[model samples]
Target: MTTTDAAAAQSTAEEREALRQMAAEFTRREIAPHLQEWEDAGALPRELHVKAGRAGLLGVSFPEAVGGSGGDLLDTVALQEGMFSQGASSGLMSALFTNGIACPHIAAHGSSELVDRWVRPTLAGELIGSLGITEPGGGSDVGNIATTAVRDGEEWVINGSKTFITSGTRADFVTTAVRTGGPGAGGVSLIVVPTDTPGFSVDRKLAKMGWHSSDTAELSYVDVRVPVGNLVGDENAGFWYIAEQFVVERMALAIHGYGIAERSLELTVDYCRQRSTFGEPLIKRQVVRHKLVEMRRQVEAAKAYTHAVAAQYVAAGGPNEAVIAAACMAKETACNTATYVTDQAVQLHGGTGYMHGTEVERHYRDARLLPIGGGATEVLTDLAAKLLGYTR
Candidate 1:
């Protein structure tokens, strides 16, 4: 390689190492201690957001101009990998970095006023934000959203509800998807709705199969009035904006998938080494050694593929059709790896793994959400088929 190329490579390595170390330290100091408490409480302290922001961990992949710490997708991958490998669960990642989903559209499209009001504070950790798209019965069908935002003089009266909203109960503002025009995709628009609005309310906190520390809510808006200025981008253009973000969100999930797998494998390896089965170390058994190797192999492969896709995304400046299909594949691949690896981790840990308080148990539960959340594996498979032109 040329001198310039070598320098660039060196610089990148240093940056990645620094990000990883920061993630490890932050997880160890700020999160791991109180993880169980937060999980039991069903929410993280709002103070955690402030600490993450102070540490520049909250907006690592966001634009610096908007109170973010100027980084890219790969930086986020490094952070996630580091955190997971250091005992942080996927639930913590989602709750802490909900901004990765919530503020992107606004940072990229919303007016400066909107950015100042929501994006800046969110990135700075002073405010919590959530993306409201999935509705009851609608699932991943963004086009079929039942929420309506009709213009009434200077304000838009929004009437509808969003379900499975991440960080919803604690969000100060939500970047909500609503119908503003005709039917289907063309009618959709994104509007920022403050939680203080009179008609907006959290219907209830939905208890989940995993990610216990992350708060999820079913939110309702009954004739909630928001200013027209709160609209993100142009009217009836939210679908494209949301579609554009799916690439990153899916990629992030892919990273989460393998990161968790890698962590589980690490925990399992240590367990196997020290765990005695029939008076011998579990690792002494051929079957146990093979299982550990298989777990590592899968985790490495998933990480490599996900990182490659992330690199391609960075190289291309943005995601295109090809990148989108590959992202779907990456997410599915990593999530499947996570499932298998975490299960093996539990199996290797024997009865200890089945216990609720065990680390491997938490990973096992957290890994279960990978395939189902973001875009479900089935839905993404269909999307990939269409993207690859397998569908007529």
Candidate 2:
């Protein structure tokens, strides 16, 4: 490479390192200590979001005009990696950064009034926001959602329920997907639904096998009155927003999956060297050694693939159909890697790994949701195949 090219690359690397350090410091001080307690309690305190926002970690990729630091995708990835490396749980990240999913649609398509009302508070961490799309009957199938928003004078009367909504229990606002016209993707629309709206209520917080610190909810909308101005983009164009957001969401999930597993592997390696069995260190055994080696290999491979995909995504200027397929592949790879690594970490720790408070154990539990959430592995594989023209 030329001297100028090398200098620019170095500059970027330095900036990434600086951002990583900032995130690491914040994770160690703010998140690591209370993670177990928060998990046991099944939800993190809202103050965590305020702290993160004050630290400039919450708006890494957003525009500076929107209360962000004007960083790129690489900066966001670095922040995620640093948080996991410093012991922040995936659940904590999800709960604290729920705005990433919620505000993007509004920022991309909402009216100026809508943006000021919701986006500003969300970025400032004064208000919580969540994306609501998954319905009771329709899981990841965005096209066949049963929720409807019928026009009634100057307002839209919304009726239906959404399940598996991340941060739903605590969100001040929800960017909801509703069927505005006929069936299929063409009839979908996105709308900003405030929690205080009449007939909008959180039914119940859903219990999950993992991500305990992140509150998930089943929400009910019974004749919810939302202003017509709340519609995002054009009416009957919600599918495009959903598709765009899914790609970024999948990529973020992929990063969280692999990053957490990488941390688990690091902890396990240290334990193996320090903890002796049968008058020898665990690392002394060839089998245990090979296990650690394999864990490293898998995590490294997944990270590399995820990073490459993220680079491609930014290069392509946000997500499209092609990037969505790539994001799916990356998420699947990272999730599978996380599962493998966490299992190995647990085995290496033997009895302690099986305990509830153990980090590896927590990671094992958290990793379970990786494949099921975002988009299921089976669904993603099918989508990818269709995208790649494998279907007739």
Candidate 3:
């Protein structure tokens, strides 16, 4: 969904530059030094969140009214761009900035109490929040939630399960999609259930081929209950709430796709300049030079297209066909770039890229998930097609 900040857009180039530098420096000092260790540990420490919150990095794109640093989506784009440029991985971004997904709904449409209880602290990095939408049996089907939330006299009793939840193992609460009315799309509603609530449990810490540093969890909500006042907006509006949020997710993942692709290209470029192939630097060969040019071309196109979509989406002030279609297209474009460029990065690095500890190697594995995460490219493509009237 488009999160509108009442605070003026921090749209100035200079502000973005400053934000970029801050993000870059933060990554260099806090993240770069220990990324490998965290990846090995399969999760980031909570202390990192506290540090980032203290630094105001956690709230860059959120409004000051809600404890954010008071900027728009462009500021977020700039921040992530800088981090990725400084070798931050997609997994790290997901784990650290889960608030990007978790808090926007509260910040936008939730009650004052909800904002105070969850959004503010989350943006401030004191508390971690997660979005629980993908159930064990279905993803990309917001209308088909199996989770049920029955309203008691003063509480919402929730029962169902969520999987592939980012930061689920560490979250203070999950802004969950639950069924409250009849069956299907019209029945769904969003309710914030604190992780410590009765019957709420992290069933398992999932192991993944990528995003290892970001803890993914299988969560069970067996009679989890929260205050009835925890409902976000009206009951049975969860489908629209979740659907809009998914668009923003697509936009975020687009940034992730191109951001990592650009970083991988830079790393590969430096390696090519130093590594000798057949007794000559790889950059000296025509084929290698051509490959580098193609990689740069893809990265540039993806970045440009994604940025344009973000701008248009922001300018639209709310959802529009152009905005939605562009968001979908941008994600597909950037995801394609990430996969292609990361593969080439590994190919160019030859044996070195295949090594476990190599930066490009990690990116190679991480890039494989961009198309699959957020929304699968195939699914988004069809949505975009329908929006663009490309479907019968």
Best by TM-score: 1
As for model 1, its CA RMSD to the true structure in angstroms is 0.9
Q: Write the per-residue lDDT of candidate 2 for residues 1-392, one digit (tens) a residue.
A: 99999999999999999999999999889999989899988887888888887888888988876667787777889999999998887888889999999988888788889988988777887889999999988998999888999999999999999999999999998999999999999999999999999899999999998899999999999999989999988999999888888887888899988998999999999999999989999999999999888999999999999999999998898876788788999999999999999999998999999999899998998999999888899999999989988897
lDDT of 1 by residue, 1-392 (tens): 99999999899989998999989999999898999999889999999999998988888888898888788888988888888878888898899999999999999999999999999988889999999999998999999899999999999999999999999999999999999999899999999999999999999999998999999999999999999999999999999999999999999999889988888898888888898978999999999989999999999999999999999999888889989999999999999999999999999999999999798899899999999898999999999999999998
Q: What are the root-mean-square deviations of the candidates from the true structure over C-alphas?
A: 0.9, 1.2, 3.5
Better of 1 and 3 by TM-score: 1
Q: What is the lDDT of residue 244 in candidate 2?
A: 80
**What lDDT does model 2 reach?**
0.90
lDDT of 2 at 83: 95
Better of 1 and 2 by TM-score: 1
TM-score, each model?
0.99, 0.98, 0.96
Q: Please report the candidate that would top lDDT against the real structure.
A: 1
**lDDT per residue, candidate 3, 184-291, as tens digits?**
999999999999898999999999989889999999999887899999999898888877777778898999999999999999999999999789999999999999
